[model samples]
Target: MKLRRRLGIEWTGVALAASLIVCGLIYWNSLSGFDNLLYDRLSEYDRPEAPDDVLIVAIDEDSLATFGQWPWSRSRHAALLNQLADAEPKAIAFDILLSEPGDSEEDMAMANAAAQTDNLLFPLHFVFPGTNGAAFDIKEPIASLKQAAAAIGHVNLLFDRDGVVRRTSLCFKDTANGTSNDEIVWPHLMEQVYRQINGESSAIFRRLGDCQQPLLMPYANRGDFAQVSYAAVANGEIPRAFLKDKTILVGATAQGLGDQHPVPLGDGGTMAGVEIMANLLNDITADRFVMPVSTTMQIALSLIPTWILLIGFWRWRPRTTIFVSVGLVIFILSASAILLSLQIWFAPGAALVGLALVYPVWGWRRLQATSDFMDGELKNYRTETPDIPVLQVPLGPVDLVTEQAEELAHAIKHVRDLRRFITDALTNLPDPMFITDLDGKVKFVNKLAQSGVEDGVQDLALDDMLERFVAPEGLEDVKDYLAIDQELREHDYVDFTSVKDEIFAMRRARILSDEGELRGHIHYLADITEVANAAQEREEVLQLLSHDMRSPQAAILALLDGQDATDENKRIESHARRTLALADNFVGLARIKSSEFSGEEILLSDLVIEANDSLWPLAKQRGIKSTVEDYTEGAFIIGEPSSLYRSFANLIDNAIKYSPDDSDIEIVLRSIDLDKQAFVSVTITDQGNGIAEDMLDQLFERFASNDDDSHGTVKGTGLGLNFVSAVMARHGGSIRAENVREGGARFTVLLPLAPEPEELV
Candidate 1:
């Protein structure tokens, strides 16, 4: 039955997945044209030019300063063009469209002189959406000049929906003559002249030109390219030799002319219309056209990536699928950028937009299906009944049978009420709860229990669920309770290991009927491993206190019994001090355990210094050498000053206590690197009888003794080490004990460094 349901889900997923794949393929087919259009637009926006041997004749602020206001007379433009002609460039194409004739006869003469150059190709303006919705029109005289110049093409620019000029006119319609002519666009007038000089036909326009091709001459948007001022050119300060054969563009470049267009290559501002035309001509002349991606290919590429993402998402968990989807999108965007850099156009915005829409829709559908399935299952459970009968009938007298029947009916109602109560109680419990029948099949599970089940495991059996989610020891205890067919209830906790390797404790109880019939087992898991360990620790400390207190008490008792020498009084006093120190450790432990320790902002360096000072006298008496290594110049920590001092003093005292007479003890206080999180570590290492490797593991454990032959032989209570550990823990720090390689015990206490209040602000 379960296999059939699973098969149904799989079939549904597969069928829907196939539909999405087919839809993606269809969408790809439809998107080709749009993507191609985008590519064409992007190509027009890209800055294309050969890296070297190209000089931009910029019309800059400097040129403006030299030439004064632009729209210089046509005679001056002719002179500038004539000067450039001396260089004998391969081609020269005019970026300026001479839509209007010059102002005077001398200007016309100069324009006619520039136009007479064989290499020059003038720009023609083919205006669209003409005035009063009239038909597109081209300047009549400008078209006539096409016959005189080398070549003439329309200069119509296009901007994106956002009003950014990213596309330039590559081809335009000549509606004036009712004929459509697709003409090649050039970067500048000089390029067209260079091409004509080299005897190259305009047919070479279809291919990208190499470095050896016609030079790209750039015109600064402010008309700065012209070397001599208009006055100088007219006055013959600019040599006629310079204008003899050059291609020159004569157009207005003054700011108020309203002839500027935005280009990404320019610094976030509009370039002069003439300069933009100049850039386009340079791009074409150099054969640096943006590589166009066909419409069909764009759609195909977009759809393929989308389908791959959907299929991967269908197979993986939600979190895993989300990560994979995000990563794939990033990869696609990065690839698009790389292609764009290489002059290959791709539709990044369209593709990303499509995926972004599809993924959320797909995920929502999946979640909806899962939710529907769960709702149906719950409905079925509510309407269904278990096979087990609530009660059995027995033979009896008539009156007794009648009364027994009423009693039985009442009992049935009572049992139903009890079951409802049990269900409600289980639902409200914070801990996870599960009940399995005598046959080891799951009878019911609470909400928390369902949550505990791993993702993707919908239906689970009792044994399998236990083995997978519950700890091994807990599972064994559960099985034992089921096998005995008896009620097993206990406050004892068993550690359950989760899939993440974290341990949790489960407290279990087996449910049974009043007649001693096995019904099912109920388990409540409480994650109290930390708390359990703390309780066990407290018990051990109490035992250690008893043993440590006995030694001092025995010495005092002996002194009272007159069993000492002439130094009895002094010996008794020393013993009393040792006892008082032991007692103090217990008091500190209790204070910390009860949350009574008052913490303050204290300098860790000062505490270390104080600890070293206190231990120096003891070290001298024991004939042990000691050194304090302070690396924390002024680092501070938030902790109880007395508690912290006592903790360090205890460690140092222990080092002095265990070290051989005249042995060296090193106490180092330094800050450890924790990836920008500062921590102060105080290390106390002693050349003493080092702890055994096995004993080191339990060194911080309360009442844990090192003596294998005799338990109480150690002079001090084990509570001292436990108390030290407690104090460190209270300060959000930790202590570890280890045996050094050179035969000594080392104890390192790590504390979090406190920041200054001013720094916090």
Candidate 2:
């Protein structure tokens, strides 16, 4: 379908999606940078190394305090290695870079110990030129340590353009006398290490040339990882027995070691240098990596879902499509969150954004086109045109003159016939019709108007006619409307005074001559008596029914609760009373419909007092406190006395029924003046299970109740509040029900106070 023919909801969804896509594109680089930082940090903290079985023998603060700042004599390292060898660890790694020559004798001892153990792997470093025109080098102790360890590998770090460490280097380059160069990578480290440990090289690292580069690992905060103090390890506080058949990494964590790099790790600081190596080791061992889908694939995936949503919305109504689109968006977001939690990097913002933007625009254009087409078709029918062409006969000279005269006569007759037809149609219409000459003298009056006019006023001037029959206010409006028509050739329609209790609408349109001269005016009067009478009858019926039925129903309920009634009889009587109450509700609805109720000024405080007195017995029987607070004692409002009483009674009854046995139902009356109009407000708040947020909007609608299970249960007719709403509306007031933030539902009735005539003026 064309875009203009799509549903509004589809178009709206598309618009949202487009907006998101635009926003995402605008912030692409920033978002990508943030993602990279987040992943790098998470990976540094949570990457699985050699499992929990691995241990770190730290050279910590306590060790420094006991044995002085690190770079302890190689002989001390020899002793520590020897102690660990007894535990039979699977392998051992040196996170620290030992480069400078230590005591020759101690280095020899440590190297000898390493050779005998055959488990240690030493770290190598990659150096790069710095900004200050100087070369920085990472030195790993090679001379004395070369023959001791099974393998050595570089722990090179790579940072993004923004200087944020995101990727790690797994290889290093070595040149000898400008003659030969060798590249050593993670595969090389693993190959030598496995060969030495297992006594044979495994096929896993055999395809060195074809293997992918360093794996991408999930990142987390630095504190997310487990760390033990170097002091504990050096003092043998760590469970040495558990180190058996495990890998161990020994590294430095002192603050000034220059190993720290800015990463999205713990507390927005860089992860300790040792932690980065540990994570890389974990990535190598466990093979946990992210294989990012290509950019093209990402875009395609995003667009496909959006297109599907748009298609579905196009086939649905605007409102339904909107709901569905919203639901889809929510689902998409939720799914994205879940995927992220599971470490699956799917493009959420891109896909959902596209969907949101495209659908709405598509739907709106579609709906607009459809509406325009329909409107064009409707216009064709509203316009008037003759079905057939008129015939013209020609004649010569004298014959032509006579023929022309005869033709003119016929044309005049046709015009007269048309006028008579119009006049006759006007007379039969429900609206009163009148025609006047340019002098404002009455020329004709339709049947309805003639019947309504006084006996002597068969023909009269417009001004005299108005003065004799129209009210002064209505007369002034008519005169002004006529004056406007005279000056502008267009006049505003004015409402005429009600005739015989019927509302009348009047409008005067100018009748112009063919020469563009003002000829006369056509006055239209419509009798809206039926419409008014129907409204008034509805109100009266509602009031009468509410009043008549309540009396009997209340008496029956009182009899049911009387002391003379036995328990069984009371139960039976209660059921009967409830049935009677339903009937009373029906009657109230009828009275409300008939417009029988009228308003009067009554003190809000007095109304509350009377309501409390009447409902107190029932509330006490249920052991609920029915309290009333009248803060507007002198404040008066206009409403039918009986209608107001019944409305409050219904609210109190509802509160009593819903509230807990010992809970309190609070009733308050107060005066509020807004926009200089006084209103008396009655609030009935109940300590009941509050209405749900979703159901609150429909609370006051007729036959709408939260209680769905009405089988054999006391169910109200649902007309009590409906009647109350009707009564309030009649008195130019309103009632609203809402769930309180704290608890329970509160029903508020706001009634307008009858203003004095002078005040109205």
RMSD in Å for all candidates? 30.7, 35.6
Please list the residue runs of candidate 1 whose C-alpha ends up more than 4 Å from where it truly belongs after superposition: 1-72, 85-90, 101-104, 131-134, 140-148, 175-198, 201-204, 207-253, 385-761
Against the true structure, whose TM-score is highest?
1
Best by lDDT: 2
Give the TM-score comparing model 1 with the true structure, all chains together: 0.41
User: What is the per-residue lDDT of model 1 for residues 1-761, given as tens digits with 9 covering 90 to 100?
Assistant: 43345545654564466445545644554454444344444444444442222223334444456666665555655665665555453345555556776566755665566565656566656566677676765653343356666666555566554444555534443435453564323332333443555555333354534322322222233323343233444345655556544334434454665777655433456766655655554555554544545556765665666667666764788788778778878877677767776756666655565567657766565545555554554445435635444443453556633544544555566568668777887877776677766666677777777775645233457778777666565667656644552334333555666654545676556677845666766667665657767866976776666566656676675666655545867667666766767677876787678655577788887777788888787789868888888888877888998888888888887787778888898988898877788899989998876776666667777877453321112333377788898889888889988778888888898999887688874
Local distance difference test, per candidate?
0.61, 0.65
List, residue by residue over 413-514, the lDDT tens digit for candidate 2. Answer: 555665667767777877677788977788888777677565644458888766654666677776777777355644356655642545666777778874
TM-score for each candidate, following the candidate numbering: 0.41, 0.39
Model 1 C-alpha lDDT versus the unseen true structure: 0.61
